[model samples]
Target: MTLIEIMLVLGLIAMLSIGSLQGWREHQQRARLEQQAQMLRIYLSGLQAQSYQYNLSHLLWTIVGKSGCVGSGIKPADCASAGDSLFKPTAPDITVGVYSEKTMGFYGLRNMAQAGHITLTNAAGTIRVILSARGRIRLCSEGKSIAGMAVC
Candidate 1:
C-alpha cells in the first residue's frame, strides 16, 4: 500500500482501540459496583438468618462515607464498639449512605420493626441494598440497570 494509505489504516485502528478500551473500563467499573452491592446483600441476609437462628435481634449500623458494623443488641450505640466490622468498598471513589424513616439498619427477624436501605454510588452507576419491612434484603440499580440486578 502507499505511505498515505498505510497511515490512514493505522489511524483508524488506533481510534478503534481507544474506543474499545474506554468501553472495557466502563464495564469493569460496573462489574465492581455490582459485586460490592451483591456482597452487601449477602452479608445482610446472613445477619437476618443469624437473628432468626439465635432468636435475637441484629443491628447493622453504618456511617455514611465511612463503614458499617454488625452486632446483636437493643441499641446501636451498644453494638458500635463491640460489633464486628462489616465490609467496606475497597473502591476509593464509591460512596455509601444509609436511609430509613424510623431508624437506621435495625433487623428484627420476627416482625417488621424497621426498614432501611444502603446506597452505593460511583462514576459508573449506583446500587441500593434494600431492607424491606418484611425483613427481605435485595439489591437494585439506580439510574442504569446492572447485569443481574433489578432497576429501581
Candidate 2:
C-alpha cells in the first residue's frame, strides 16, 4: 500500500478508537451507578427484613457521608459510630447520600413509618434507590432519564 494511504487509514482507525473509548467509558460509568443503586436497594430491604425479624423498634438506619449504619436507639451519630455497618462504595470520585423524612432514626417495624432514599453520584450521572414507609423499594435515575428510560 502507498505510505499516504496507510497513514490515512491509521488516522481513521485512531479517530474511531477514540470515539469507541469514550462510549465505552460512559457505559462503564452508567453500569457502575446502576450497580451502586442496586446494592443500596438490597441493603434497605435487608434492614426492613431485620426490623421485622427481630421486632425491634429502636434499630435505626442512618447514613452518614458514604456510610450506612444501623443501631439500636434514636441517635444517628450513635448509629454511625456504633451501629452495624452497611456497605459503602469503594470507588474513587463517587458520592453516596441518604435522605429520610425522619433524619434521626426510623423505628424498626414490619411497616415503615417513614420513607427515604439513597443516591449515588458520579461524573457520568446519578441514580436513586428509594425506600418507602410501606416497605417498598425502587431504583431510578435521579431527576433525569438514563439513555431514554425514566428514573423509577
- Best model number under lDDT: 1
TM-score per model over all chains: 0.83, 0.77
Q: What are the lDDT figures for the candidates, one per model?
A: 0.71, 0.64
Q: How would you encode candidate 2's per-residue C-alpha lDDT over 1-152 as one tens digit per residue?
A: 99999999999999999999999999888777777667766766676677767775534454455444333344555333554455566555567666665642234655563566667778778777675667687777866776554665
TM-score for candidate 1: 0.83
How many times do residue backbones clash in model 2?
0
Q: What is the lDDT of residue 146 in candidate 1?
A: 85
lDDT of 1 by residue, 39-150 (tens): 7888777777766777666665665663433333443543245545466676766778767655645444464436778888877888988888788788888877887678
**lDDT over C-alpha atoms for residue 4 of model 2:** 100
